[model samples]
Target: MAPEPVRETDPTIGRLVTDASRDISSLVRKEIELAKSELKVSAKAGGLGIGLFAAAGFIAVLAIIMLSVAIAYFIHWAGLGLHWSFLIVFGFYLLVAGLLVFLGVRSVKKVKAPEKAIEQGRQIPQALKGKS
Candidate 1:
């Protein structure tokens, strides 16, 4: 007796399921790879942006120093002694810096720990053990 030939057009249920799972897995992997690549580009751009911002901030600081010098020179032109004019500008900057440090310390002292999240974290092991 001759055996029947397998038809390619009609796939078995098991074969279909296997094909579907393989296709889904491939799709998921491709999506993950795409996301990783996109994230890499985004991270590179973000790093570049941060560097540019830092450069800008440094430039701004230089500009501020120049302005401070200009102000001191203006004060000297207005008949104050050059040394005293520079000294006054230096004193003003020192006072402003001290105030900022004081305020920063006060703000930092107000920071509290995350109490609720900590309590929930403590409950995680008990929950896993099936205890309330």
Candidate 2:
């Protein structure tokens, strides 16, 4: 039986394969880093959202207390005692409530989803290819 000759890839092809593999490995690493960065941004945004809710709740409670005191004062000024003072206090509370609602809505609307890090990471390869 005749011995079969081993076929080898050209050096250029071999180098291309090596380079492609390295490029892919680097791309994978960059994707992982991008995901990590995105996740961190998302976590921070979530934390901010929670904090905003907490602040809104606190402010609501404080507003209620303040409105109560204001009503008492209005009643004393009216010379009608606490009974008639409630109307003025209630109006004040309505204004505060409206303002708070506006602010809360604004804050919620301002919250943005984290930008995709992987998308940005992919651009690097595209840019490199373009430059070539």
Candidate 3:
């Protein structure tokens, strides 16, 4: 097969500019596509993690319900009437719940804002501008 002769026409500035602009536009579109694909994957993983966490919490709640019933039955066997046994179990759960709420509130109150980190971040601009 004979090789085709090369006809090289020097590209004009306008042509070069148009080609560069087109290439940049194509590059930007490709980058946006890549970002969308990456975000889809991350969102899927995040949704799965949330689902698993909810399942774990649901199982824990079921376990707690079963334990409460079992404890109530045991109390009944220990000579307490069935009604009183369940009542005692219910009261115990209420007491525990109240204690948990109190502790949770205390722990939340003890939490302080990140003042040191905020101060450091504020200093960054000053440092960069040689004003620190």
Each prediction's RMSD over C-alphas, in Å, is 6.1, 15.5, 6.2
Q: Residues 25-100, candidate 1, lDDT per residue (tens digit)?
A: 9999999999999999999999999999999999999999999999999999999999999999999999999999
Across residues 65-87, which tens digit of lDDT does each residue of candidate 3 receive?
99989999999999999999999
Error of 2 at 113 (Å): 33
Quickly count the clashes in candidate 1: 0
Ranking by TM-score: 1, 3, 2
Provide backbone clash counts, one per model. 0, 0, 0
Inter-residue clash pairs, candidate 3:
none
RMSD of 1: 6.1
TM-score of every model?
Answer: 0.71, 0.45, 0.68
The runs of at least 3 residues in candidate 1 whose Cα sits more than 4 Å from the true structure, single-residue gaps closed, are 1-9, 105-132
Off by over 4 Å in 2: 1-15, 83-132
In model 2, how large is the Cα lDDT of residue 83? 59
Residue 14 lDDT (model 3): 95
lDDT of the structure predicted as candidate 1:
0.99
Worst 10 residues of 1 by lDDT: 3-12
Q: Write the per-residue lDDT of candidate 2 for residues 6-75, one digit (tens) a residue.
A: 5675357778999999999999999999999999999999999999999999999999788798767867
